[model samples]
Target: MTAKPTLAVVGATGAVGAVLLQILSQRADIWGEIRLIASPRSAGRKLAVRGAEVEVTALSEDAFAGVDVALFEVPDEVAAAWAPVAVARGAVVVDNSAAFRLDPDVPLVVPEVNAHTVRTRPRGIVANPHCTTLTMIVALGALHAEFGLRELVVSSYQAVSGAGRAGVAALRAQLSLVAGTELGTGPGDVRRAVGDDTGPFPEPVALNVVPWAGSLREDGWSSEEMTVRDETRKILGLPRLPVAVTCVRVPVVTTHSLTVHARFQGEVSVDGAREILATAPGVVLCDDPAAGEFPTPADVVGTDPTWVGRVRRALDDPAALELFVCGDNLRKGAALNTAQIAELIAAEPA
Candidate 1:
């Protein structure tokens, strides 16, 4: 690796890709030449990065040449097919896709938690954790380092944007449809009101909450629920840690919120947890209920740090803690985390 690595941003036309570009522009200039690559349909378009307009190129073997680092934000199938190609052309891939996350050779990293693992990528790829998992892991990673996590019971209130641009468009369309009308939660009230406007969601996201995210699996858990459980364990390096997750689609536009009930080995205290999170990097402690202060999606959107609040020790169990966390699904949850890992690699290349 050279002093200034040549970087490539794959899927540069997508929502997360846009956030990645913004983050790149905000950070120091550690990159030399930045190449933008997207699908054939998005090719010939130009995007402004670091005060320069770079034309998007179609993904091909030539595009990967001379790229020292490739950051990807495409779908699973796309990453599965193209990551090796980028690696074959001698670029280290930091992928924000589910394709290589669970692969044994690919390391799933959150720089705050497992920055050291980025150096051990046998497949020349590092997978970013699920957005929902990234939302809570920064704080939990700090807590777990102190308290030793044993189990987790999480219920996620994910925004429509987690489903990508289509999900956001669907919610906006439904909100427009029900703007002047009375929409109820009764049988098919929302379904009829937003007919054929659910986008990628299973139900209307404007007037109601969908109890599912991702495809249903044979074990009755959605793919998202499984991703949260699996990715959390992997990022924390706790393979046997028991995790139970329930995913729901909320009406919010950008940020994702989670209610985490964590059980740790040994006794835990609220003051200890608060003290740890207060000083932890990439985390903001926002707990103060009497002042009507707690992290919310409306306030946390566009922020890079995970906001943690409503933290308390479980009354029935001294070793358990309950907390609420919120973060921008696109920024910190997806783009920022990947950027952090890539920076780590840039700082110390193999």
Candidate 2:
């Protein structure tokens, strides 16, 4: 029998990395060796995986030795610097960072939407899309497949965890401050109570919504908003597809939710779109307003599939449909997608 491939998980101690370890433990074990790697400070830490504990090694060129696949869950700068090193060491890199997502040579992949693009990676790197895009793309891809998507208008209700541990910490701290008090009744009251320590967010995220996520970009668009627009177009192979997005940071601890307005070619039917989303791989349709069943972050957190609901045809435009989608940003948005891509590569003949 052929020997199983060795896999390396970079940033093994991070938030997404933690979830990745859980996913690896839950999924079928196809790896002969799973190496845990993190920053120098996190080295020597042992993390659980596949019913065993693996010690994390510090990030370095030597860590990629004999590894067949390397999954990166580090910051964009870390990935930007080390991914090529992994490639040089003869490892296929599946990076979950914005560093290579838009590189014309590096394929931005969401397995359910564009699995075929994985084989065309000239840089030996596959990029996972931003959490906002991943939160909605699976359902959109399903509809686009049948109806031919033309344009998209999206507004995101992103979880605090999407900003990493710091964001989660900030929200919890602020929530504690405002939990039993009448703080939000007056203007600037929550801000005064939460103080200037908003962690990664611009304003207090608890008991409030900040209409910003990433750094400011050109034309008043945030980096994250543009990310959803650009990554969606790329993943769907629609280079010029019109996409408008507004990303807001919500107090939720996990899972990202988005309201999507997708305009497709020709007339569309609510029944037809519902059927498409209901049967789409990596998607779950939960539309039923009468039963109070629609995708929400609280219900969708900790799940793998993108949960979609509120499926309806636009009243004014027969060519458009509006829907809501939710997905665990840390899972399908990061770890799960990376794991799926690595599995796809692992299944290929060596």
Candidate 3:
């Protein structure tokens, strides 16, 4: 490794990819060459990074030749096919897709939780956790380190942006159509208003919430729900931790919020929980209900750290704690985390 590494941002034209570019430019400099790669349609387009214009190149085998680190933000299928090619070309791939997250050989990492695992990547690839899991696990992982977490019951209020640009556009269009109308008053009114414009959601996400995200699985759990369970376990190193999750799509444009009830092996307290989160890396403690303080998607959008509030210990259960957390699904949940991981790799000893 050198003092500065050549970096490649794959899928540089998508939502997360655009955010990743902004994050890279805003952060400190540790990269040599920053290459932008996208599909043929986006090739030759100019994107501003680090205060300079960079031309997007079509993703190809030659694109990875001199790339020391490749940060992928493409679809699962695209990543599954191209990541190995990048790795074969000698670039360590930090993929932000689900394709390799559960692969035993690939390290699914959150730098705040399991950064040391970065060096043990047997396949020269690291997987970023799902945006929902990334949203809450920073604070949860901090508390788990102290209280020894045993189980989790979590419900997520996710924004439309989690589904990408189309999700955002659909929500905006529906909101506009129903802005001054009476849609939420009757059943199917909102759906009828936003006809054929639901975008990536199964139903209208304006003036109402959908209790589903991701594809339905055989076990009745949405793929989004299952990701929260599985990714939390992997990141926390607890395979049998007993996690239950329900994912809901809210009308918000960005940020994902979660209400978590965590059970620990030992007794816990509200003050202790507050103290841990106040000092935890990648966490911001914003709990003060008297002054009307709590983490909300409105307050967390475009932010970096995971905002945690409403910290309380279960009244009847001394070994349990309850809290609310919010994170920008596009920032810490995806882009910044991968950027941090790539920086970690850049700092590795030569």
Candidate 4:
């Protein structure tokens, strides 16, 4: 048998990094050495992976030496700077950031949808799609494979954890302040309770929904919304696919839910879509209206697969189908996808 490859987990101390560690532990052990790399402050910390404690080394040029594959869960800037370093040091990088998702030389990968794109990476880096895109793409990909997707209109109900640890902390703090109080009914009531600590969000995310996620882009479009459009098209190999998106930040902790209005090339039936979703890899169909069975963030959190529900053909348009989908943003949205891509690279014959 070929020698097992060495693996490096960059940003091994962040929120997604923590979840990645758990996933690495639970999955099949395909690596020989699992090297943990974090920032300087986190260098000495020992994190558990594959049932063993591994000391985190601070991010540096030498850290990628002798590593076959490196999984990166750092910020865009950090990834933009360090991913290339890892690649230069002979490590194939699977980065979970927005840094290289749009790079023509790099492949934006979702294992269930675009696994074949992994081998064509000329930049030696595979980019993971946005969490919002990942939440719905698997189910959409399955339906598209059958009916041929033409257009997409999606609205995401994102969780606080999508913004990282500070977002989660902000929601908890705001909830604690407004828990026993008679707020949220009057004007500026929740704001008064939340004070100035909105964390990464522009407005109070407790007892509120902000119709914004990423920074402002052209024509009032948010970066998050544009990411959904661009990444979806890139992953599905549809360059001119019409995609309109509106991203909202909700009060949930981990899971992200989206209401997708997909229009196919031809008439689509609810039964057909349901069958595709139910049997598709990495998708779980839970659509039963009369019994009040639908995937919700609370129930979908900590799960791996995309939980899809509310499957119905549009009443007015035979070409359109409306569905609700949920996924743990930190799991399939980030770490698991990165890990899956790395595993794909590992599976290649040396």
lDDT of 3 by residue, 1-350 (tens): 87778999999999899999999999998899999999999999999999999999999999999899999999999999999999999999999999999888999889899898889899999999999999998899899999899989999999999998899999999989999876699878888988975899999999999999999897799998888888888889999999999999999999999999999998998898999999998899999999999988887899999999989888889999989999999999899999999988898998
Q: What is the per-residue lDDT of model 4 for residues 1-350, given as tens digits with 9 covering 90 to 100?
A: 13699999998888899999999999998889999999999988999999899999999999999999999999999999999999999999999999999999999999999899999989889999989999999999999999999999999999999998889999999999999888989999999889987999999999999999999999999999999999999999999999999999999999999999999999998888888988999999998889999999999999899999999889999999999999999999999998999889999988
TM-score of 2: 0.98
Instruction: Report the number of clashing residue pairs per model.
Output: 0, 0, 0, 0
The better candidate by lDDT, 2 or 4, is 4
Clashing pairs in 1: none
Clashes by residue pair, model 3? none
Poorest stretch of ten by lDDT in candidate 1: 181-190
Q: After superposition on all CA atoms, what RMSD does each candidate show versus the true structure?
A: 1.0, 1.1, 0.8, 0.9
The clash number for model 1 is 0
Off by over 4 Å in 3: none
- Candidate 1 scores a C-alpha RMSD against the true structure in Å of 1.0
RMSD of 2: 1.1
TM-score of each candidate structure, all chains considered together: 0.98, 0.98, 0.99, 0.99
